[model samples]
Target: MIPLLASLLLVTTRPAVSQVILVEKAYEYVQKKEFGKAREAIDLAAANESTALDARTWYLRGYIYKELYKANPATGGELRAAALEYLGKSAQLDTSLAYRKDGQAVTRYLVVTFYNEASGDLNRQAFDKALTGFRNYLQARSGEPPDNAYATALYYAGYTSLLMGNQSGARQYYEQALRLNYRNSSLYSDLTSIYEAAGQDSLAAGTIRAGRQQFPGDTVLRITEINLLLSQKNYRRVEAIVEEYLALYPANVEVMLVAGTVYERISQGDSLSRESYFNKRKEIYRRVLSTYPDNFSANYNLGITLYNRAVDLIKAQQYDLDIVLLYEILEKVSGLFREAKPYVEKAYRLSPGNLNAMRALEGIYYNLNEKEKSRQIRATINEMK
Candidate 1:
């Protein structure tokens, strides 16, 4: 009877084996900074039926995995993801809020990781993964007030979505960022382009106008507004706006090109004022060439303009006029051709393969009585055929 009682006491005094013991072991290993061992113990605890539902088990597992990720970032994406999962589980299971605060703090850290990874993914052209990572960052930051960082993330999300060909999604993110006062000028420009591509011209115009209001000195926005007015055939408004832009940006080459084209377009319609506008067009092209001597458009346009005027003069010449008068007219036509020669020759040198320049050069040589050069150009044209 004594042996039986002793045996029974021994058995009763010993602790029963439970899955919670694994969780306790994990915590002990964590205290010693032995995260590898802690991870093994906590994973077992998390897999067991009894401790799997225990909040302490999940919290310890989350902490262990998070530590592993911190130790080895190069191989830690899966580890960090695991940590987030378990931490979320712990927060969900802990009705008493025992791990809620710590879980949230850890989540904020993980959110930074998500954002960093998203930026890397974006640089690598991993559009789908980048989009997901950005959303994860934003979701983690939900309920936060709109700030510069938040707005910047929104812009990135929109940019990523645009790269993914998700136009509607991009529009939503951009609009949200706009409401938060995102200060990037590209945000407005990109959104405007999207609206215009969707055939929402009014919205495009409104967005660009808003962008110009916000960034009054933005050259791109100014040019975009000019183009929009041109599209609407609002020539009067376009001229007024272009003159204002020129006064502000006197040496802006792009604006000068636009101004020259505008003058040419106006001359085509206003017959009574055609010569005046044509002179303005030529003057603008000359100004561009003075600054950018090698500008192809300026060289080609000026040369062609002079060439066409000479041809028109030749066609309108009066053969019935007196010989002296005819000689004067011939001199004027020859003078115009002489003025056109060097420009067309320079244009031909700039783009040797351009058939228009080649043909123009041939005509210029023929008109200048350079029979050999004209024949050589004609032979080359025939050879190309």
Candidate 2:
């Protein structure tokens, strides 16, 4: 009679003991990052109704699956699906617990994470997958997302459509994003390129013009406008733009370079005498030097200007003047040469077989009558060949 009663008590407590023990073990395994063991224990606890349906327990399952999905994304589709399932269950268990009133920030954060995961798929050119992920998030959300969220999602969707060669789809999405007050300069730039590619130059220009008004200080947009003018051979307009900007920002090196380049282009276009052209070139270089004494562009342009002057003097049988100008250039521009050498060497280091820098060095050495140094450089060039 005593043995029979003891057996009955053991049978009655077995289920309760198993449920508690499995849940405790699962928690311990999760703490240790032993995901496989944790998953196994959780599965066992989940099968037992007494432990499986707890809201916190389901939430932990979701968190674990989300982490696993992140660790190995290629094989994580099912895991992420499982996470969504468990999280949904948790929310169903307690609607108020899905997002806290005081910590509504966490909800926004999760929304952003969902968006980021979708965007990652977009970046990988998995347009269908990205769209599916985004749609899933939209469907799951109780209300409409904020303006920025809508804009970002639309922009990425447009960009992906563009990549997939669906210009109309891209345009639709871009318009949607724009409607949401999305004012991204890069998106505008991309749209301009797309319009231009489709042979809609007028639309491209108009888009860029609109973008310029929105982003008034964007130098890239200005440069884009300048390039457009150049491509159309509107030299006078480019010159006017340069002159206007130069008047506004006289000390800006980039503006100075642009102005100098415009002047050089004008000089080149005129089929004038070499002397007249060289004189104009000299004036441009002098103006550059006046503004930026130690500027790389100014110094380099000065060296080229002096070199041209020396060449003209030599052609006119003025050897003494030619030698004097060459000497002055070497003395005044030696620092420029040293400063530029590192950048040129870096290019050569990246592409060791490239002869452009070596050839430039050879010319400089040859001009200086350093035949032995030129020969050494030539030997390295030959080895590369």
Candidate 3:
């Protein structure tokens, strides 16, 4: 009877002693940064029937494995796979543990860390690894509602699909991300590009419009929407929009330039006489020139306007009048040409084989009736060939 009692006592006390030892060794390994050793201790503690079934033991085991996987230099897929396995076990063993103040915080931190690491893989252009990591992060947070990080994960996943050239997948994921939160401006840009690439210009324009409504003051979206309208020849609407923006910020040069171009387009489409239309064009160009003297389009258009006026005078056989206007143009616009020369010459110097600058110089000389200068420019253009 005495021997039997002794055997039962030893069996009972053995587990208690093993549990204490296991806990101590695990903590010691963790303090020493020996994550592998710490994981081993936790694994041992989790194997014995008496200690293995405890929630804290399983939680510690999961935490140790998570740290180990994070510290490992393995690929994102490998790390995520291992982390998912451990976190899955912990979640299953104790769902309530996640809501425990400290437990919830720790679990959230782990989830976020895993997500970011996976995102880094995606950023490195490792699409497959990133996909796996994102999947693992979602699985680990199985019962949670969509949070900011969750939304961001969906966005990145869509972008990864784009990088892989999977258009259908990209659309699905981007839509999912947007459904969660349409306030993401950068995601709108991506969606716009995707639709534009797919030849869905109307859809792209609508997306930009929606983005503008959501982010009223976003200059980039406003500009893109305006450009799309201009491309579609929706000039009246663009004119109205530009007028609104000009009212808000009157001295904006870019807005003024676009407004001028829109006016020129409208004038071209009018059923007006050349004399009437030419006068209108001259007024618009003058307005742009007055406001932005150094603007290239303004200077170039002013030159064209002078040439046109001279042509009109010549058509009436008013030679003296035309010559006097031409001389006045040369004197008044000399500084514009001089300023433009450096830009034209830079292009020429950069690509001596290019004909763009040579052609421009030739046109300028021809209009001025400088035959020697025109001949030199023509030779340069020929040599570029």
TM-score of each: 0.71, 0.54, 0.63
lDDT of each: 0.85, 0.67, 0.68
Candidate 1, residues 9-83, lDDT tens digits: the string is 777644434567878899999999999999888888888777888887888888889899999986798998899
* TM-score of model 2 (CA atoms): 0.54
| Candidate 2 overall lDDT versus native | 0.67
TM-score of 1: 0.71
Write candidate 3's Cα lDDT for 1-385 as tens digits.
5699899998889877888689678978878888788878878887877776566666666566667666654644454455445555655667566524544555676677667878888878888878767766766776898877777778777778778888788788788889887467767777876787778998898888788888887766666677777777887798789779878876666666666666666655654645564565556555665777556655555455444445444344545567777667555455444434544454455555656556765665665567798899898777757
List candidate 1 stretches off by more than 4 Å. Answer: 1-21, 24-35, 67-77, 96-98, 121-129, 139-147, 163-169, 292-385
Q: Flag clash pairs in model 2.
A: none
Superposed Cα RMSD, model 1: 5.4
TM-score of 3: 0.63
lDDT of 3: 0.68
Candidate 2, residue 69: how far the Cα is off, in Å: 8.2
Q: In candidate 2, what are the lDDT values of residues 1-385, reduced to their tens digit?
A: 5699899999998997887788788778879988888888877777788876676567667666766776787677788778767766665665557432312332344456567778888878788878766756654453655467677777887777777788887887787777777988866777777777677889888988888899987766776676666666777898888777767776767766666666666666765754464565556656766765545555555445444444444444545567777666555444444434443444445555656667655655565566897798899988887
